[model samples]
Target: MPRMRSSSVIPHLLREQANAVQLYLQYKGYHWNVAGPLFRELHLLFDEHATTVFETIDALAERQRMLGAAAAYTLEDIRLASTIPHERGLPRTTQEMLERLIAAHHVIIEGMHEGFKSAESDQDPGSADLFARFVQAHEKMEWFLRELASEPPPTSEVTGRSSLAREKGVPAAAIPSSHAAPPFAGPPLT
Candidate 1:
């Protein structure tokens, strides 16, 4: 009989499952509570995201069981293991809900990155692949949220000249400057 290798990937998988459960709950909460101009759209989006994350939780838990590790099944276990925070009261606006979703996605991405590192150290290709998929999904979701806040590039009409001038290092004196100081310089002065 082939020797059974002990996999250290279970802990990372369990933690990821816990985080996904927390995220799924938060998404469902926002779906139920979201309001405003985009309520219907946001409600549907949250529900879809929640379902997807919930699916991930199930898969992770099953994988853990397949590896002979016990999966954490209780809410308390999830809460204790999750790095994502459970917001007490959801925000009132659709935009706020979007912002909250973005924050949660960021948290998930961070956790998945850590999970990937752990899985890699354990030589667990399966968990590493799972975490990579998560990173991609979270990044796409973040891009969607960002699109809501995006505006067309400031028109040359507003700047009173083409951006080309600024790009070529034209003197500030030559450019028609707006009263609003260019949003803070690159970094705080040392």
Candidate 2:
């Protein structure tokens, strides 16, 4: 059986797992709905981050089981436990998406920090390490989002292009400079 302190850490871990799930779905939704000059870059970035979050969710739930604890993972449980805000609809712009994600990461990162401290206080090194890793991951993702927010808006070169070009199978970077347009290359945009 796990130590008592380790058991104490399980609920926090479960809450983090729930938040990770929310973050994953939110990232993917933005990946699909994001529009604007930065479409391609943001698209790929969100997808990559979402994949990472999905992995983290799996690992966390498994970790709970490893500790012989019951994992709270149902959608209802996640809805109840997670602090990430509910999204009623897509953000109106790419900037909004970035801001939304940044805000969500802020909450998750804060929670991770608190959870790490709790785990340590509880004398659960394993759980402490897990929370530490999660904090690092969220910090990295937050840095990426914040950096993107600070970047100059996409040049006018990409301003006229439909976000569909990026979504539809054409590489965003390949969409062509004003000097020349390249043929779209990729699987059919479906």
Candidate 3:
């Protein structure tokens, strides 16, 4: 095996660590603010996922230490390194929160793939393994969110027409709807 270079692998670890911190904070926010029919389930799930993500931070930082670099810890350092998008404010609906979480997971998973490749090419099997394991956790969390968001096709109760009718180019008159689709609701106030 080729000798490992900290320069080749530490950047990947730093980015992953930053992402983990951001994701963990986002999960905590959702866990605290989520309110709806599935409140209990979503609340608990968010908290559980947050805890899992939080636990990985230490391992990530320690990996950087083993590679002879100080781990990123300050908010400014994390903010600059993190790729996760910041949430504007509290999500108006639980569904929106799930969507945001799913997107965050996607970002993390994408970064992890790159990190894993870099580590593998640099002959750092330990970091590569770490990336692989963490990406799997993110994937599992995304799966849960996707499953929760899935629902049967949306059909208007009065017209008995599926929502996709419009997209499919079916004549609107053929459906004979008395009601228009609900107007777009804007973001909630802080």
Candidate 4:
């Protein structure tokens, strides 16, 4: 079988590169800003994911270079190429951050699926393999986030009031006030 044309694979590689950079930055933002009850766990998770995403950026860029195309380095170039939606501001809760990260992973996974198909059909095994591996990584990350997002709020052990008491027929006031609100639910940092 004939090898795929460089033109056919380069665009997909470049797009992935841009998405990786954007996702890395978003992860870092959440990592640095996360606070409240689950702050330590969420912060550590975000930073770890950010590092993983950051590692992808170089491989994606090099893949494009191997295809004989110029790797995009300018901020404007990445902004234009990335398909991840722009954020209005920092999320109001850890749940919101988890939701956003899950959605972003979905976008990247979908794009990788398309890119993988294109590369495989074009007989480019290397590019297809890269897409497949990244897809698995993104899927794992998404699953971790989804698990966190799906968890029910903790019940207050002392008073038996759930954090989601208002929705569970218990008086909201009975819930623990200590975990009522996120510590950083304020204006975006300058």
RMSD of 1: 11.0
lDDT tens digits, residues 1-190, model 1? 2112267677777877888888888889888876654567667877887887887887889778777777899889989988776777866555556667788788888878888897898777877888898788778877876665333256444343334334433222223445323554467778
> In order, what is each prediction's RMSD in angstroms?
11.0, 9.2, 10.8, 10.5
Which is the leading candidate under lDDT?
A: 3
lDDT against true structure, model 1: 0.71
What lDDT does the true structure give each of the candidates?
0.71, 0.78, 0.80, 0.80
Q: CA lDDT of 49 in candidate 2?
A: 96
Candidates 2 and 3, the one with greater TM-score: 3
Looking at candidate 3, what is the lDDT of residue 33? 88
Cα error, residue 133 of model 4, in Å, equals 0.7
Give the per-residue lDDT digits (tens) of candidate 3, residues 63-140.
998888888899999999999898789877676788788999999999999999998897788999999999999999
> Could you tell me every candidate's TM-score relative to the true structure?
0.72, 0.76, 0.78, 0.79
State which candidate has the highest TM-score.
4
- What would the per-residue lDDT of candidate 4 be over residues 87-149, giving only the tens digit for each residue? 779987777788889999999999999889988887778889999999999999999888766
Candidate 2's TM-score reads 0.76
Candidates in descending lDDT order? 3, 4, 2, 1
Kindly state the number of residue pairs that clash in model 4.
Answer: 0
- Which scores better on lDDT, 2 or 4? 4
Q: Name the lDDT value of residue 167 in candidate 3.
A: 40
State residue 9's C-alpha deviation in candidate 3, in Å.
1.5
